[model samples]
Target: MEATRLEPRTLVNGDMVAIVSPASWPEESVPAWIARQVESWGLHAVIAPHTLDRRGYLAGSDADRAADLNQAIRDPEIRAVIASVGGCGSFRLVPDVDVDALRADPKMLVGYSDITALHQVWNAAGVPTLHGAIAGAHGDHVRRLLMEDADTVVEADRGALSAELTTSGSVEGRLFGGNLEMLARSVGVVDFDVAGGILLLEINRAAGLGMVDRALTQLRYSGALDGVVGVALGSIDQFAGYEDRGWTIVDTLRDHFDALGVPVLGGLPLGHIEDLVTVPLGTAAVLDVDHGRLTVDSPSGD
Candidate 1:
């Protein structure tokens, strides 16, 4: 966990960035629209061949999706890689990631949700990545980080969130984490140990509080959080059933992590939030729970 020597690569106006579908296929018009956004920023957006392929719930056959991502990772001219969207199928593409290829010529890997699997893969190999959208909410944040390699501070209104926390201390460590369910599934399947790092968790869906409890409990029991010092919670989007039970998702989360005895800061506008603030995974950061601030100590992507 020493500082990653994977020096940041710059993205100029003419640089080519690849948008590949690594999970479920996106709607017909999405990739092109995302490409236009990239193009508007003065970078060439190359939609990877299989970005639109549809194969049941996946973007394409596992091999095809993997080939697209591997080629994008290995391509000398593609300066960055973005997932078209997050869906149920990304874990299936994990085996085809070609980590060695990513290690040799690491580029900026960006996306969230299902993309968390790919982010962990690259981060484990010492390459940093952006846990943000490929477009829309915070696309400019992504563009700025990939282009400027800037330090950032993320804060959110604690009163407006469906999340909660415990403790009142500060935790300093490298920042890492993504979709809560995806992270829970990553245990044993991928190298996602959050030990010695501040875990960032965001949820896109939850059937009920019980399901969230089970997911977090599973992650804890699997030893994936062996030495984790703290957690920074972000968007818990689209979850149901808290209101009817006279509770909140925050209450459920608090009950789950209270025993860990670490600072837990919630209300970060990350993951699937409308005003998403792009965060650099695997970068050094300080989580000040008392003040509710997350300060990125290093230039994201650097």
Candidate 2:
């Protein structure tokens, strides 16, 4: 396995977290709601200067958004950095990020969807991130990881996870994946280490069945899934939209993933779900398909 990441020191009740927007703009009330939510965890929330700034669809200009994120990453008082929401502009901000400072002062970064680009950047810098929202049921999981410990274990099954097994077996490897589309977009551009890892995927939009199939097919063609040990599928919000004249998303999933000959388990309450669960990206994990479990092996240290 590749060298595991060195997670930052866990936050405490008195620590502070910075909320910024590197992607599209969130609702006017979102940042405030997130601030309140973080405060409830006993941690103060520092809303970045440009967090709510608007420039068309993005929270702000690419430079400004990147600045907000870079500032949060460089701030010593910030115990954690979370995105306010996900949109299209994050990928554009990646180039301007202060990668050097981020590496020197690594802190937890959490978000999903377009934030997947940011997560990939952090993971590459040896900082694992939580894949979930900053608010709601899944946010609780993110809070626990930040305030408590990284040496933790997470499980899924019929009770906590309403998943179905397309192929059944067991396997263990580092966890890698987020928004399927974002991940696929990074196939050539980002050095995503999917090799020998359990790929976790979820859908945020009901784009189309063809697009979904094409994305997965692209991943396969790019050899991004090469040596991948298993696949843990997460929530597909509005999944019914893909059903057309008997052709469902499930059929599409089985078509693409089953051929990989790896354990494929779907129905995880993760990403774009009614209840999102925080999933650590670029961490060693295990997937037991037969038992319907995906356990994150939160290590003690690097």
lDDT of each: 0.80, 0.78
- Best model per lDDT: 1
Cα lDDT for residue 204, candidate 1: 71
Candidate 2: residue 149 Cα off by (Å): 0.6
Model 2 poorest ten-residue lDDT run: 157-166
Candidate 2 residue-wise lDDT, 150-200, digit = tens: 543445545423264446888988887888888888766767666788888
Summarize candidate 1's per-residue lDDT along 202-249 as a digit string, tens digits.
887647767787789988888888788888888775654445377667
Stretches off by above 4 angstroms in model 1 are 240-247, 297-302
Candidate 2 Cα deviation (angstroms), residue 72: 0.9
- Residue 63, candidate 2: Cα error in Å is 0.4
CA shift of 73, model 1, Å: 0.5
